[model samples]
Target: MKRISRREVLKTTSHFFVGAIAGAGLNSVLQGCADTSSDQSAIDDIMKKTEMADIKNIKLTVLYDNVLYKKEMATYWGFSCAVQGLDKNILFDTGMYENTLMSNMLKLGIDPSKIDELVISHDHPDHVGGAMMFLENSSDINVSLVKSFGSSFKKEVKERGLNLREIDQPCLITKNSFSTGEMKNFTKNEHALVIRTNKGSIIITGCAHPGVVEIVEQTKKITNEDVLLVMGGFHIMNDLGTKTKKIVHRLKDLGVNFIAPSHCTGGEAIEIFSKAYGPKFINSGVGRIITANDFI
Candidate 1:
């Protein structure tokens, strides 16, 4: 796997838009929709249609990440997961690069065209990197994202003719699944997904810029259910000494039964969480799968 710096990633992403506009003859259409801002009022009007009914089992497959679990899976600096056994198949985040995302999906036997819902945690390239590529393959699904994303990004979704649901408050994606809404930290805005199972709720995050503990607490507030598993990037890689440890303890205190950190979660933090959670810690890397029965 090749290592890519954030600067290089952003540069390449900019070039992608340029190439897409010219090659797809979308310059005029893109420009025409550029000023069309997302209608927050309309998005707010959309309500949850179906609820998950006491699902005893749910499966989450890590499709893309910075860590590799299978020998053949490509590792990259991003996160994407497939949530199954819900009312609909949900895709959480689209990894950093187009080829890597598509290749990993292919290897995992996942067809992007079959995904019913796309939930973007934030606007970062690592999380939304494969948006255009995946959208090209499938526009038959609804896209749920934070309102804080760039206007141009929202415009692109609208222009592509996909249903866009802009969220700012905690809401049910389906009856048994929920979003933590848009949580603001000093630097970024993010939302974490919560899936209800007979055992407990599974909270899935992307980078967790707003703080993993904070997101977990918000999920608890919404569902009033204990979190059986807390997975995905915790974003505390640079936390020097006791900071990450404190966060780990806090999560344990909050009744998180399992911890499976990956991507931006540093190695040292994972070790701390592993020790703290003991057998409850599951290795979360690209190609890793966690089923609800594992928790029960």
Candidate 2:
């Protein structure tokens, strides 16, 4: 596992974010702890007998519909995330097609073989373009392909015998989930999807393009935690005045509670992250349904 060179892994991940900003900004500390509240009914009464894993009842369906879905065309956006479960139904990125993402996952009834897992965050095509029509309509849905543009698409992803894994680092996928591999690349091949939830860390990205605050400071420096929720795309469209309010006050001084932001995250940068995270911001498209029990 000494194959570095992706331009020296983006210069050693930008020198580990400039030596973690003089030893404390390891993307600005988090050390596990996140309940980024708008007080979801007091976090639903402290997770009300929390032990969520087999997805008791969850749903986030948006097969693919650009223009950030709404908010009046929000300066043209793009993203496709479909997450539903009672027992493993996931489809992170697959917009752009698949018959309009299987007629918007059959108008959100979602039965692409109960969609086990299909994470393709990079290799754009509006995020793996409906992932080969969800493997041509569920070939026993068990996909895990997460490689970013290399090995030349691995022979049509190994002739669709997929279950591929080209993730270069950071692991776990089920079991307090994680996956930030092949990141720090800047141009393409970017990655992000860590979900450790007992109260913190629920990062998910698609168009971050390497710097969504450096991919949530490299997933809290590879899981030190507390980054409650950092939805998607903060590519900061053309940095308007005061550098987008100092990048939303440096993501609220790195205590990032919640900031949905879809597609290229424009529309005046979601109105400067809704006036610098006023209500802890929210607006992720395609039938939103974000949960956090530490991603079970």
TM of each candidate vs. truth: 0.84, 0.29
Cα lDDT of candidate 2 equals: 0.57
The Cα error of candidate 1 at residue 33, in Å, is 22
Off by over 4 Å in 1: 1-56
Q: Give candidate 2 misplaced runs (Cα > 4 Å).
A: 1-91, 95-115, 118-128, 139-194, 197-200, 206-225, 228-232, 241-243, 248-296
Give the best candidate by lDDT: 1
RMSD of each candidate relative to the true structure:
5.9, 20.2
Error of 1 at 127 (Å): 0.5
What is the model-wide C-alpha lDDT for candidate 1?
0.76
